[model samples]
Target chain A: MNERQRARRPGGRSARVAAEVHQAVTDLISERGYGNFTVGDVAARAGVADSSIYRRWGNLETLLSDVALTRLNAQSPMPDTGTLAGDLRTYAAQVACEITGPDGLLLVRLAVALSTNGQQGLQARDELRDERTRQLQSMLDRARERGEQAPDALGVLDHILAPMYIRVLFGIGPLTPDYVDGLVDRLL
Target chain B: MNERQRARRPGGRSARVAAEVHQAVTDLISERGYGNFTVGDVAARAGVADSSIYRRWGNLETLLSDVALTRLNAQSPMPDTGTLAGDLRTYAAQVACEITGPDGLLLVRLAVALSTNGQQGLQARDELRDERTRQLQSMLDRARERGEQAPDALGVLDHILAPMYIRVLFGIGPLTPDYVDGLVDRLL
Candidate 1:
């Protein structure tokens, strides 16, 4: 490996620690649900000291927010199908899969629980929404450039994203392929 | 007073205890969020013995479910405007108010947190959904009786209720009257 690459190794100790801690948080949320565990519990599960966790994340909420934001950004890259309908359908379906996965509902519940917390929690919620909105705006802007009629970013959020989120949040029903496509159809 | 009438007074001891316990749960959820408080905390706040609460609700989740269900049922007796469009708009507006009210978001977050707990938590989630569906069904059935083109109850849930819920849960934006009406208009 080149000297510069060696200095910035991807699998460094810090990266390994972060991965372990995140997995610990995810497992705890799945097994016990949100608000039922502590930072020490996470430390124990990850085989790290509580002091190390506190030094890095400073608090439980920050750690939880990091775990959620990291997973969300990593899950679905925005779709670019060269057409608005195709992009929307693909995007919605990917989201359905992400939220229905093993860690999906647990992470979602964590985000919701954090948003109701305090000022810090509010900031985390805003950051997550802004990230999702930014991704959607990029897709819509591309459609506009190609002379396609694209809906507003907020419209997509209300009609497409909101329904899926509410369904997963309340266990309302399954996000079938047809249902995901239907949301995109209705939005268009 | 008549013997039976006196015996079944509205302000009897049982009713008073139930109201106090419900109020206490609401206050705790508002201050601490779900899963942060326990049955003993609720009992202490309600000024009732722990045994009393345990005897009535069986557990913390059940007590929380009771609080949410009672509040939901008590709010906004489903609107019955003559036409489908009118009924939908009115009903949406009422729900907008209910969910944005003091105890609204707290109760919603509680239901969500409970849903991820276990089998008992799943039951609480199902009961909440069933109650909402039952309410929507009555309105749609009335619309059909009047020969109006009524969408299914689930349609109203997806198009109207889900958007408002997601907005509140994530602190996305305000649920203005124009926005609420737009959802109903789109659904119709």
Candidate 2:
């Protein structure tokens, strides 16, 4: 193999290992929760040595943060649907699908745990939130530029989006397409 | 005092005791978490006899469930501002303020615990969700009758309301009145 190809091989291997470790940690947290699951348990679950896990993630919170909260695609490309309603329907449906999925549940659990555990947990929780807010702001900015929305569209986005997450985390109802469309029509 | 009034006083005492016990349980859960706190701990914290707690709430799960899951609204008056936006903004602001407060945080933590515990927890979670949905639906129905809303006006309420809960529970952002107004305008 060429020198460039040889150098790339280790990068690929490390990425695979990272994915495995993240998946293992997620399963462990889901089964045992953040408090009960230990580093040793994650290492064993990931089929890696303790040193490998620690060296990669630094600490359990960091490890879980990476596995649970850090990996989401906080930014979605805003749809240019020509109307606020059309754009929001697309956004709502996509958000509903993601928030109801396994990833969404894990993140919800992590947020709840962190929010109640004092300053350290609260800081982490805030960072995660800030990331999401920036993403939503991006979508709102795009909508304004498209003229499908009014001068201050973020308010609309905030009201419409906030309840869906609440419902999902609280197990309020199905995050169905019909629900998303209905919300889009009424709100936008 | 009459003998009848004196005899009925125990019922009044019992109600006060129940309220105190519920508050104590909520505080303990937020402080120590559901997994660590025991029935004995709850009773001790509540300053009630062990038997009284058991008699009132049945078991640890039942006690926690009742304390954490019970809806707090005791016959609140619905908003009637004559305009859909005005009514929703008022409602959204009220709900937002509550969710951001201390009681709201405790409820959120309990919700996370229940949601993560699998099917048994999910049933309780659904009931909590339904309570909010019913309230929102009622408001929407009222708007439609007054012809202040379109045929599908409730869709706006769903989109506007969902994100606020999501943001609050997940530490996403502050649910301000301006945000609620923007949501109301877009939806209506």
Candidate 3:
């Protein structure tokens, strides 16, 4: 390999390990629910040493926070449909997929479970919320610049994201297309 | 003591035991979070025998369900304020108080944590949800009968209750009077 490829090797390997560890966490949460598994269990599942996990994440809560925040950041980019309604519908639909996918509810549960543990968990929760709010604000700003009326960030959160998250949290019902779009339509 | 007083003694004792046990569960959840404690922990905290708790509730999940459902049933009666908006505002405000009160988030966390364990857990989650939906339906029905325009039961759930629950779940913000009233106003 060239010098460039050689320089990239360490990061590439580190990325692979992180991906494996995250998958292990997702799997364990799906099978066992939050707070049931530990760092050792995650390491065993991911084929890594316990020290690797602790060294990387400090503890299980930190590791869980990393997994959740990483996933949140990795979610689909902000939709920029011509109109605010189109943008919201697309945005809502994307979120609906994330929360309903194979590991969706598990991560959502992890975030909720983490929020009540202590100061660190609370900080993680706040970080997740701030990231989401920032993303939503960007889209809202774009709409405002385009001269279309845009709802406030919290309004989008309360009307669109809150309903969807609550539904998943309680396993109330499916986040159908009509239901997702209906939230945006009502907000508008 | 009179015969009636003597007859009520056993029932009163039974009620007292149940209350203490429920409070123990709530306290443990707040202190330790779900799945971190057990039946023995609750019994010790409640000053009751483990056998008594097992005999009455069958298991921890059932006991948690009892605490949540009982609290849900014990909330204020449906508001009849001569208008749909008034009733909704009153109802939302009551829920905001319930969820933000001392043991409110703990019970909600219990309900959420219970929902993921197994079939029994799923049933407990469903029952908690159904009870809330039934109560909302009653209010909506009253509004309809009085010829006032009322949002559908699910609409209220999606718009009002969902937002409040989500907020508490994440410790997002306080449910101020204006915010509570704003949810009702938006629904109307």
Backbone clashes (count) for model 3: 0
Q: CA lDDT of each candidate?
A: 0.81, 0.67, 0.81
Give the Cα error of residue A32 in candidate 2, in Å: 0.7
Question: What tens digits encode model 1's per-residue C-alpha lDDT throughout B1-188?
Answer: 77556535789876898889998988887778777888999999999999988877787877888788787777866777788898888888888998887655765577667866678787877777788789889989998898888899878877888888878877766899989999998888
- DockQ-better candidate, 1 vs 3: 1
Q: Candidate 3 DockQ category?
A: medium
Tens-digit lDDT string for candidate 3 (A1-188): 98546535766866788889999998997788777788999999999999988877787888887787777767856888888898899889988999887666655576667765678777777776777779889999999999988889988888998889778877877888988998898889
What's the CA error at residue A25 for candidate 1, in Å?
A: 3.5
RMSD of each: 3.8, 5.6, 4.1
Where does the lowest 10-residue lDDT sum fall in candidate 1 chain B? B102-111
Predicted complex 3: DockQ? 0.52
**lDDT by residue for model 1 over A94-169, one digit each (tens)?**
8899987765565557657776667877777677777777988999999999999999998887888878877777
For every candidate, give the share of true A-B contacts it also has: 0.53, 0.71, 0.45
Model 3, position A146: C-alpha lDDT score: 92
Best by DockQ: 1
Error of 3 at A168 (Å): 2.5
Q: Which ten residues in a row have the lowest lDDT in candidate 2 chain A?
A: A150-159
**Runs with alpha carbons beyond 4 Å of true place in candidate 2:** A1-13, A47-55, A69-94, A101-104, A118-123, A126-161, A185-188, B1-11, B47-51, B58-62, B68-71, B74-90, B118-120, B130-160, B170-172, B184-188
| Predicted candidate 3 versus true structure: per-residue lDDT over B1-188, tens digit per residue | 88546535765877788889999987887678787899999999999999989888888888888887787767856787887888888888888998887666655576567765788787777877787778878888988999888788888878998888878877778899999998888778
